[model samples]
Target chain A: MAAMIERINVLIQYKDLLRELVVRDVKLKYRRSFLGYLWSILSPLLIMIVMTIVFSQMFDRGIDNFPVYLLTGSALFEFVNSSTHMAMYSVLDNSALLKKIYVPKYIFTLAKITSSVVDLVFSMGALFLVMLVTRAHFSLYMLLIPVVVIQIYLFACGLGFLLSAANVFFRDVQYIYNAFTTAWMYLTPIFYPIEMLDKMEWVRWIITHLNPMYYYIQHFRDLVLYGRFTDAAIFWGGWLFSFVVLFIGLFVFKKTQDKFILYV
Target chain B: MSEEYIVDVENMTIRFNLASEKVDNLKEYFIKLIKHELMFQEFLALKDVNLKVKAGEAWGLIGINGSGKSTLLKAICGILKPYKGTIRTVGTIAPLIELGAGFDMNMTARENVFLNGTVLGHSRKFMQEHYDEIIGFAELENFQDVPIKNFSSGMQARLGFAIATMVKPDILVVDEILSVGDYQFQQKCYGRMNEMLQGGTTLLYVSHDINSVKDLCDHAIWLDHGVVKKSGLVEEVAAEYMNENR
Candidate 1:
């Protein structure tokens, strides 16, 4: 407990640097593009359009609010996918600064995640517009969306810490993660309903029970598209999985951080 | 444990593992791992090092390449964790190990001043309070809006130097940063450092140029092969190091 408190204090002390790093990430990301912040919204909208056109006719079951369904899955999954990929390079990218001075090492990962969260927030604006166009109802349960967002953030942050630390020692972790996310996306049932695989219930059960992103994305769709909370089992399971991954991420990052300077 | 010793290092050791061969991808690494073919050779960067720096004392570290001078400075600055000992630092530390290290090349000079200032742990309000002073000192009044990538290396160094030293740090770790920039700007930096020294900031400086060490330091240590070969008054140690190297 004392160690946790001390770590929090260290984070509080370096808050300004963390803020600056996040700002730099956000600014540099959009600086080269002509549309700047608009790309955050447009890119996802464009993807949703392409995927909806490509997959709608084949997989559209009796699902209501198909646009919101597609938007929620793609937006939230992109949050985890792109955020973790960016976080993997956070420490290695700042090797020059790491060798020069002492700042809390985790700040880099946290900053990268925060920048992605900013992009995610902007994309939420696009989600709201889609909800209006599709005439989706906003229930009181929609307030629960914030809770789901926090869970996803924690999940991404945990993976961020773990991947950034590992990448410092092993340069190939980035490529491996790229391949992993591509396969993982198909397994998560982003564009189609799991019932389409009812013939393969065992595969559906594995995806539903085992994959954390399945839980996160499912909760997101429940709150936004279905207008309700996930069942108690899944709600608590998602939170538990997020915290466990966060625990492991912090554990590995703290244990291996001191050696990062030597490796990088 | 004395109150006057602002920097204390005792029995500190730093070791690095250099991988024997190139394994660029994880496939090769995993193959080596399963076959027990992975190998690492341990390199001791600093061995059983002990040092103390009192408040207001300016010390120079003189050494040939690969003698662990920069490693010692980094250890003091808390950049590298020591393998086997304790380092107790009593005050705020600013390490000028490399100039413009935290900069984003696409940002304008004005933006990086704030960015670098925050990276050095200064608050936004603190930067706001000293922004003009930093610009004035760097002589970058006209180049504020220009992207730093377009600036010459010396100009970037000047901006880095100006922001880093704008406030008096309680303990400063400088690593060969003064050797860059034009001669006139170099003299100006030296002048500012002298003023800071007069104001009682403890300084740990590492340099290859013996003349600057002799002129700027009151005490010195000569490190050779990861150990301190000689340490004492600046003149005595400088003479010993010069005689040995020559």
Candidate 2:
């Protein structure tokens, strides 16, 4: 054994702790709710119906089988949104454990991100059934799921790790994150498409360039509605961006997590 | 370094910010952020605190509420990194910092034990192997399937303690976790603590329970206002502490 320990080694050791915590999070959530896990898919369905109707009028391009189109975005976008929001609150929520044990503090944030992805799996199944019934063209590109899932997981974990750790010290990060996610929904092409952004001459391309969510929403749009794999540039670029954000988030989180026991 | 001392905290200093008195002071906020001055130190929780705990040693830290006892334990556990100084420990460190710290109330007692055991540094396989032992120690055999939220504070504490000590942490850092459980459970805990001590686990106990300290500890340290006032044999130090306060 080396005298100096690598962080990666510690992270690997604590992976089991992360899994156990994620399981508890998922089980604990549905324990009391009347509908339990069904709400994962049902809520998306309700939102998708309303969004399809709303966006169809706004864009005037009325997608055939628009509900399924809306479902694709709703299901995919929910994973990103829920993961970030849950991650922001996770450290605060797990304060009791956090102050006691010194496992990677980021594990709590990752656990929230993981649980949201599990719910995302459910949301995807609901969309798949809708697509099958509607007879939409499904293709081999759907196999690109492993790529998409990994990208979204890294993307959400990065953002969640950053926001949750920030929430520990800044206190206002929680409120700001809540507001940012809601406002961020309109800014992303979830309900709309790339065509809308093309019309906005005043909005800089820089905005989408900076936001990783834009790339993810685009990949989601490509996979489900268009029955195509995302552009190779997007698949790689989005992952690279997520990767960098994860490192940055980890640096910030490790530096500040010690202060959480007091603030939280 | 290997003579028997399991814990070595040298000049450990912990600083934490107090909740702001002024909510609308954006001026203060920007100034603090920009200055980031070390001297602007908002609150000093622990300062130059040093100690050593040898193998099979049961040492207790006694102080009034908010006297930095918990802060010291946390600093030793690496939950709070000291602004100055180092804490080097041998073997695994299990901190029973909060009674139900890692537990989710909405999950079953059984569910929490596995998860809680993991947080205390036990592998899931280790948990699988020791599942029966942990539940047996907690005396939660019949109610393993029930959500922990329905259990009383004492039951929760017992479960937390059982899972925490199950890993046989080389150095156990406990902070006021004993107060939550009833007398019987506390007795069970004391027996467990004694067993761990006999097996050569270093115990770092932080509590306001003077008698508990007097009974279990071979050495006692009195922490007042983030600094140590006394550190010596249990009887003399505890007597001095009692006299100073009285």
TM-score of each: 0.97, 0.90
Candidate 1 - CAPRI tier?
Answer: medium
lDDT string for model 2 (B1-246, tens) is 634668888888887765444322345566766876323436888889889877778889987888898888877787788889888888888877575668777788888878887787678898999999989998989999999889998888888888888877788888778888888888989998988888888888877878999888899888899999888899999999889889
Instruction: Tell me the tens digit of each residue's lDDT in model 2 across A93-190.
Output: 87777767787778888899998888989888888877887898887777877677888888788888888877666677667667887887777666
TM-score, model 1 to reference: 0.97
How well does each candidate reproduce the native contacts, as fnat?
0.68, 0.71
What digit string (tens of lDDT, one per residue) describes model 1 on residues A1-264? 998899888887788888888888889888978999999999888888888888888777756667788889888899999999999999999999999899888999999998999989888888998998888898888888889889999999999999999898888888889999998999987888878878998889889888998898889888888888788877998999899999999999999999888878
Best by lDDT: 1
iRMSD, per candidate, in listed order? 1.7, 3.0
> Candidate 2: which stretches are off by over 4 Å?
A1-5, A57-65, A204-208, B1-4, B18-28, B31-42
Worst 10 residues of 1 chain B by lDDT: B17-26
| Predicted complexes: DockQ each | 0.68, 0.56
For candidate 1, lDDT tens digit of each residue in B1-246? 467789988888988876677565678889999998787677888888888888998999989999999999888889999989889899889877576687889899988988898888888889999999999999999999999999998999999999889989999888999888999999999999899999999888888899998888898988888888888789999998889889
